[model samples]
Target: MHRNLWSGFCLSSLLAVFSTLSGCIDSRGIIPQALRFDDAKLTTDQTIRKADRTVEWPRDQWWQAYGDPQLNAWVELALAGSPDLAMAAARLRQALALAGVAESEHAPQVKLDASVQRKHWPADRYFYGPGVLGDTTGWNNTTALGMNYDLDLWGRLRSDTERALSLAEVAATEERAAALELQNNVVAAYIQLALHHARLDIAEAELKQREQLLELARERLAIGIGTQLEISEAEAPLPEAHRQIDLIEEEIALTRNQLAALAGKGPGEGARLERPKLSLHGEPALPSNLPLELLGRRPDVVARRWQVAAEARGIEVAKADFYPNVNLVAFLGASSTTGDMLNFLTNGSKLTYGIGPTLSLPVFDGGRRRGKLSEATAAYDLAVEQYNQTLVAALKGVSDQLIRLHSLHEQEIFVGHGLETAERRYQLAEEAYRRGLTDYRSVLEAQSQLFDQQFLEQQIHAAHLTAQADLWVELGGGALTDDSGPAAEQLDAHKTTLHLPGRH
Candidate 1:
């Protein structure tokens, strides 16, 4: 018999069971072997160099390299308390449970049944007990063993088992994704808080310089040398700085509150983060030289690809109809009739098993069954498309991050020079003001320049770090840390997490 002939027969049966998803799939649409984005073509690859040395992150939790104890403690606390992580754990168990279910289906189901009964008869009633009607009525006991099995019958059960296993893998990937996202959010929030604090300090220092200038200007005005407008202008910087500082305080409070919730702690109850520090592993390396092919290794992409295959199997399972199916069912368990277990063991002899063959062949079903098969077919196609799209999106994110990282690192370098210049000017302005050659206005202007430059530095540094974090994610570490379960597995030799579906 032709393989396609049998496949069609099985599919016809599926049409009866599953509802047809009309128009969900393109009937004539050629599902391109879902194209992976050409990453090499997209990226302008270059090595990033730091003044100190060459650095490569090597998939380790590079964030720890910064040596900030406070940052470490906060991450630990948040990991333990995060409800989202807990939820992801629960999902992992669920997937594992489903795998168990599929595995169990491959084994025979065993059952034991027992019962007891008491009956009273009228004084003149005729009653058939086990003693009277050959064990039809009770005080009576009966026992037997039974079992049943569904033969593979065109590999439907096997496909089902594979589908379940794939689903479990997808769940594991989702867990990893969740962990990565949770940690990223925590780090980002901490950076934001640190940035705000640094800004506030800058503002305050600027304010103090302005206050000194205001006092000097007012004194000069009293002696008719400084204008009233000059004193008023000198006073303005202090309030502005104070207001900026107050705003930063509000942001810090908000960030702390968010961290508290994420860490599963009350506000101000856990490890406090000091000023943020940047620990970047030199420049990030693109995953493998072949960027497009490497995307298959990404957990998110692989997980969804598994779904596509599983859906294909589901369609096959539904199609199990076109061929004749033979089932082998038998029972080999002790069954007892009578409330007393003792009587059944003593009175009934133990018996072993029986087997029977049940066959099913599709005759006709008004195209209903065929419709279901088509529906599954369409679903598989849809799944494949979605998987491809996710891969593209993942590649795009990586490319975008690399571009940003390159530019931001350069921007920071330039900004560093600007800051140095501002510092030098501030130093010169102080001497001039003391010598009474320059007005207090020059002192205030120099202070403002220094403060602004410093503010830009903090922001640029944080932006650069964040860009790296995102790049790591896009490259498929997706938050794989040295100690993490899947992350550890992916890097080290134990259970391999490398299931790239489309990659050669």
Candidate 2:
């Protein structure tokens, strides 16, 4: 009867312990309200023209749309070598490692401990004063294996791990954003360098023409057909032309150095690089309708969305802290005070072991737990606000690019006509002066007017190219694919399972 009773007690104790560990408080009911935004309000723009509707989706290799091999090569180099990209990748790795740490917390943790020490105990120092232990001196050795498992009875560990997982996703999106930014910057710098190159060519050509006119003026004056004032006026353009050339050269040098840095190389690295002749086939095509789904393709938006999810998980973690914490701990060990230290390893040595579950309940925390929960909720609110702000900014960015492109295209037509008229007038003035039908001043005025128009055309062309680049960047640097559909929609499928307040 006693044997049966002992067996029943052991079985009952095991069942009780297992039952305690298996129970988890339901905290999902208290999850904050869903996050919402009007899709039409975010994507609807009054500035999109009908022409923009005749567009297609952006390509993954959008830079290739410019049709410049050198430009494509440079961008690839930057992507491969840029230090900014390297750092972003490192951050992603770190976040993933931290996520691993959070996961490890949910698993059983085991530790081994061992110690050996030589000690002399004098019983005389205690109640006996002279030789209580009988000069007890020996080597004490101990070894133990301990195991612990925290019973997540409130989903605290799960919530913590979810937060970490979301953070890792955030890091990955941030890296993508960094890469997009780097590519855009490199393209812009290359465009500027090409503009300066065109400027230099124009300046040199103008200087040669101006020098020819100066010679003619000097010849006319010597023959008493031209005044010294006409000669001086013609001479003035030569120095201006030289100055323009000097400035353009300096700008080209600076731009090359900038590109080199973007490529993660020394300044001198740009010296051997050739000038880029990047030209666009046409303005990049755009999707007829931009939905909120497409807008989420922007890395910044995705990262922020992930951040909001992570913060929401943080709220769950804080709430879990208000509940009781239970942990199962077990230890097995042997200790021996014999002169032979290895005796601890023998089964004959004294043994000590313990195994049990521990429970802790908060009684008087002075509102610390409540304060933390409040803080987490506030953080979630901040993340949601930031996400909204980013969405608005992204929409505005696309609209701004569209407006600028439209204005530049309209101006291009007018600038082209102006350039042609100025060229004709300069030709007429030069011919008249050669035949002694007009003064040198008329020729100088015509030359200056023509130079201004030519420079204006180059500036406008560069602006057009840059506007195209900005548009591509706003469209997520062509990172989206048809398979992915829209980034927001893709995130939605996963977001549905998350405890965040946001709704697609």
Candidate 3:
């Protein structure tokens, strides 16, 4: 009796010590350091200008600014059916479901367990050595209802739920990013298709002109008025023009195939695509002053931010592992001696019930808890660094695109003037050659220079449009301007849909 009293005293002292340690650990909340960045402090080029800040940002459907119904249709198709976007959407749903699972931990869980079985026990069983509870070889039946719930004394469950919610938000943003990517790809492809059409037209016109010049040269040579050298020079550009036609046609066909694939359709669908008539000038006008914080609205940046938040919450969860876990458990059960299991549910049968709390504290674990805490802290730090890098890259992307657009605008002006000058020079050279004031070589050289100038002009025009498309995409396809919660909401609304263009 004295030993039993001493053992009880020792156990009480141990419990008291552990309870004190748990309180101390709980007082030190696991909160990661906060991160912040200034909106106007990022590095920007001198070409950046200030515009009316009051002007509204671009709409989410910014491609509509191009006024091309076909482009709008294609973008809608890609957004709804692109495999990449669908994958991101699926990931987001999975994250949300995981979050729901985490949330369920906050509530009590109850389970009903029922079993019926025949049992054979020796009359000399250890607990009842002489069959004290009646015959030991009869059928045994039991039924129980059990309930268990974590007490969450240290806010661990709350932290876990928050971490899951943050991850779900990250997935939501990624889905938006994927949708934006699909929109950008479709627009760029459509622009390339248009450029191919222009190239083909230019090649055909140049080839026709070359054929006329070749005929004129052959006629002059036959009449002994032109040298064989002149005929050979005229023949030189004709084959190149023909080759350009073939090459451009091949590119157009390939581009259409790419668009069809992007829209999640068969290659034959590409053959039905018409030449795009997109006007690129002054469409989707840019805001005057772009604050650095605006880039934070980008889906990728937002996703990275959520990643940091989730990792920060993870640290709290890991730190909670160092403290005691408390649980409330209860069970109500009945046993039946006969083969009829339903007898256990009757009031007359032997009944048993238990209700109590369980507490567990880690005294030793080979430093596993400390290691987990360290890992969580390190992961949080990594997430912060990654978020910083993503922000920097986003700023650079915006600056680079701004510089490119400005340079293209300047180039277009000069190329336009050069094209006009070359056209006039070619006209003068042709008239001079017809009157025999200049050699046929002069006319051929002038005409070749004119063709080169025209091609350059066409190329410049195409590049300007493509640059605009690039800028549109770099700006997140105007996703930042929308107040929608996430692209996941859009995906959910279209869960049962194959074509979602009309739905939006």
Q: All candidates' TM-scores? A: 0.74, 0.86, 0.85
TM-score winner, 1 or 3: 3
Predicted structure 3: clash tally: 1
lDDT of 3 by residue, 313-402 (tens): 998898888888989999999888864546777875798999999889876676677677777877888888788888778767766776
Model 1 / residue 299 / CA error / Å: 2.3
Q: Give the TM-score of candidate 1.
A: 0.74
> Which TM-score value belongs to model 2?
0.86
* RMSD (Å) per prediction: 10.8, 9.0, 7.8
Query: Candidate 1, 265: how far from true, in Å?
Result: 2.4
Candidate 2 structure quality by residue, lDDT tens digits, 1-504: 999999999979966765565343323434455474554555456675333443455678788877778889888999999999999999999999999999999999999999998878666666646753447888778999999999999899999999999999999999999999999999899888888887777788788888999899899888888889888888877777899899989999999999999999899888767867565654444444454645767899899899999999999899888777899999999898765878888876788999999877665566677677777887898888888888888888888898898898788889879987998999999999988899887888898898788878888888888888998899898887865442221111100000110110
- Give the TM-score ranking, best first: 2, 3, 1
Q: Pick the candidate with the highest TM-score.
A: 2
lDDT-based ranking: 2, 3, 1
Candidate 1, residues 407-432, lDDT tens digits: the string is 88688779879988998998899778
Clashes of each: 23, 3, 1
lDDT for residue 38 in candidate 2, whole number 0-100: 58
Give the range where candidate 2 is weakest over 10 consecutive residues by summed lDDT. Answer: 495-504
